[model samples]
Target chain A: MTTLSAGKRLKSAVCSTEIMVIAAPDGDVEITCGGSPMGDGATNGGAVDPGHAEGTAIGKRYVNADGSLEVLCVKAGEGSLAADGDALAVKDAKKLPKTD
Target chain B: MLLEMAADAFGDRVAFVDPVADSSITYAELLAAARTAAQAVHDSGAERLAMLDVSNLAIPVGLFAAGWADVPYVPLNYRLTEAEIDALLERITPAYLVTDLTHMTAFGDRQGVALTSRGDFLGMARGGGGDEDYRSMDPEAVGVLLFTSGTTGAPKAAVLRHKHLVSYIFNSVEFGAADEHDAALVCVPPYHVAGIGAVLSSVYSGRRVVQLANFSPEAWIEIARTEKITTAFVVPTMLARIVHALEGQESAHMPHLQSLSYGGGKMPLAVIERAMQLFSDTDFTNAYGLTETSSTITVLGPDEHRAAAGSEDEAVRRRLQSAGVPLPGIEIEVRNDEGKALPTGERGEIYVRGDQVSGEYEGRGSTVGADGWFPTRDAGYLDEEGYLFLEGRADDVIVRGGENMSPGEIEDVLLEHGAVEDAAVVGVPSVEWGEAVVSAVVLKATATQTELQDWVKQHLRSSRVPERIEFWQELPYNETGKLLRRVVKERLDSA
Candidate 1:
């Protein structure tokens, strides 16, 4: 478990997955990959579990329900991601009308 | 760091396309090229990396490389005269200048400067000859040095730091928000603030960018259609020309164009209304900011455009003329000459405060106040609902016999006339009234000066009418679409 902040990058302890925080709520939140807590730096050394092997996709944002916390997948990995035991879903692409 | 984020997020996605070269690069390839370019900059012993070429793949490479190497990226105006270019080059000595073959020959032998052709720079970027790793740069370090378009006076280099740009992107754009098929058309020159902002924001949002070096109404429409460009930004003058180009057509004929944003000058109400009708499927945004404000501080968003265009309420419809409210994390206040915040609906100088508002010049440190507010030097007022209506630059305001008047106000009324194609209002010297409001007009159809004068008198007070009106073939405008009011004032004053 670590304190969450915007722009902080977290890497999977046992996979090639890396995620950067886009938005975060106050308080410590446990962010995990392959059922293991994510670390502060990139280190691709971990076993992938068959049950959690859906993997993260590059260029997609993963967010929790209620849309308070969001992380952008920086690298693809063979491990699914979760936050606080809840599986994060890929965020829906926003319509381009909001583009500046 | 912005490019790094994009590379990591969508390395396999195409980041940019160079149609003229018949080439494109994925985000990963662009990242690698930037790293290599950074190494070359380091090896060249240049304190700053300057690009004087037209828009191309190498511009982004040079921009990101400068950031990676912790040097200020300076993009010079390629349209300037040789003497003007040489004068600017002398200011940023010990610089690595990237240009085309023609300009390289013209400037390659200048002392204290290392010249690299655009082709050579692109080649070096793709060659990946350097082994040095990309270094993280400080957020406070100057990231870009943009020489302001000197509409009023000699150009000054407005400095933008990494923090300001990063904050702007973070606050405004969601990460990885764009669809894979989305591409943005960027036609503005690299030296313009919107050009830099567009490159950074589009890359960070994981969208492909299609750049047009030279702009023409026909070419822009053709390219936008062929490329299936989903989003685009244009200056007001560009939009006006485009509207004129599409005259008599049922629609813009661009089904894929989702959003169109215009800024960098006052957008005429007639032009925007016609644009909204023509590009019926497209969303329109009026983004207002300056070179010192890191692109957009206030945006009349798509929703507001739609609301104003479709509304029956007069107040709501008038928002189409306003610059809209401040963006997230940005605070705006209209202040009087004594620096006191003005009441709602009272016109005064617009002041802004935000993480993205740098307001710093190269030699003149920061102009931001201790309270963090930076007077924008623009005269405007906020509605009761906080929509900002810009009234031209404060210096451009006409003081006629102790009464203050905004040129934008007179110009807007002139533009509302059906016969007027374009109009510029400037303060000309007057022996009796201290200063007089003089107007230069470009008419679409024949209208007598008396008729146009009566049109303004009916819309506004008699004092707001121009003391003298001059008919012109066309009003003067800078390449980026800023009305050359100084030129107009000089001409009218001399006459």
Candidate 2:
């Protein structure tokens, strides 16, 4: 179990999925990938569970039901992202007005 | 962290393009280049990484590389005279200087200076090799050091920390929000605050950027057309020239141009109105901020522009001249001379407070007050409806015979005249009055000095009317569109 924070990049220990935290609620929140705890960018491969084999996609944001935890998928992979065994849902992207 | 976010989120998407070189780099490629450049900067024994070139592919690489190498990125104004550039370069010794060939030879012989041409820098960036990881940088580390245009006094380096810039992006821009096809055309010089802001925000949003080294209305319009540019940012003068260039034509002819944002200088109402009519389909946003504020503390968004233009109500329509509302997490207050906040509609100095507001200079440290408010030194007020209206810089206020008046008020009246294309009002030394209001005007058609003087008198009181009127083919402006009031005053005073 690893603490979550904004801008923290977490890589899957089992699959090729990579996620960056966009928002996290106060206190530590355990983030997992394919039923295994996520690791930092340097973490290598580990065993993958078949139960959570759904994949992640690039440029998509996943958020929990409470909306307190949010992570953006930076790389696509076969491993699904979860927080304490709860699967995250693809957040509906909001179209922001263009301003430079 | 910002560029890394972009690279990881959308690695394959194009991050920047150099049309002159006919080359482009993906976000992944940009990240790799930054890493390599970081290694060179680390190995060069340079304390600060300075870029002294025009907008090019090497710019972004150098910027991110400096951040990755944990060095402050100083983008010097290349338009300055040789002596001025020499002075600034001397100040930042032991600097890794990435400049064009011309400047490299000019300043390369300095002690403890590591020089590389812009092309060779890009070549090195393409060849990826770096040991230091920039992702673990301290939030408080200085990210950029921008020297303010010394219109009033000696240029001071405004420092922007990583937290400030990151907070600005996180608060205002959404991560990975841009569509794959969306692109921004960046024409502002690297020295300008808008230029830096544009690059960072565009990268974080995952939008492609097309750089224009030199700006002309013809070139700008052509690039927007050929590149299918969806969004663009320009100073008021640029938009004015674009509008003048498009005169007598039915439309701008660029269908892909979706949004146009203008700032950096006060925009005349006449120019914006004409531009709105010319680019009828494009959304216009008026962004207002300072170099110390990281960028755009307030923005007059597209909806407000349309509403103000279309509305018949006098109050609603006047918003076209206002600077709009503050961004989220930014607090703006108009305060009187006594440092007391004035009620709405009472004009005073503009002060801003926010996480993104650094308000710190190189040697001066942070000028931010105990309350976290930074005096912008600009004169303006919020209307009853909370729309911020800027009334020129506080130092630019023209005091004539003890009656303090705003040049912006007088200039706005002058611009209302149908014959006047542009106007600048300055206070000149006067034997009779403490200082006399002098006007320098650029006219769209022939108009006599007496006629123009009469025009101001009819619109405002006699005291506000310019005592001396001079007609000029064009008024002096900095490349970024700021009116050179000091230059105007000097010229008129000497004459």
Best by TM-score: 2
DockQ, all candidates in order: 0.24, 0.32
What does candidate 2's lDDT look like per residue over B386-457, in tens digits? 999998898888888998888988898899898998899999989888799998998998888889889988
TM-score of 1: 0.89
What do the candidate models score in CA lDDT, each in turn? 0.87, 0.88
Q: Count the backbone clashes (under 3 Å) in each candidate.
A: 1, 0
Ten-residue stretch with the least lDDT total in model 1 chain B: B129-138
Could you give candidate 2's per-residue lDDT for residues A19-100 as a string of tens digits? 8787898887888888788886545556667887888987678999999998878677888888988999998765445557
For model 1 the local lDDT of residue B33 reads 95
- Model 2 lDDT at residue B61: 93
TM-score of chain A of 1: 0.88
| Candidate 2 positional error at B72, Å | 1.0
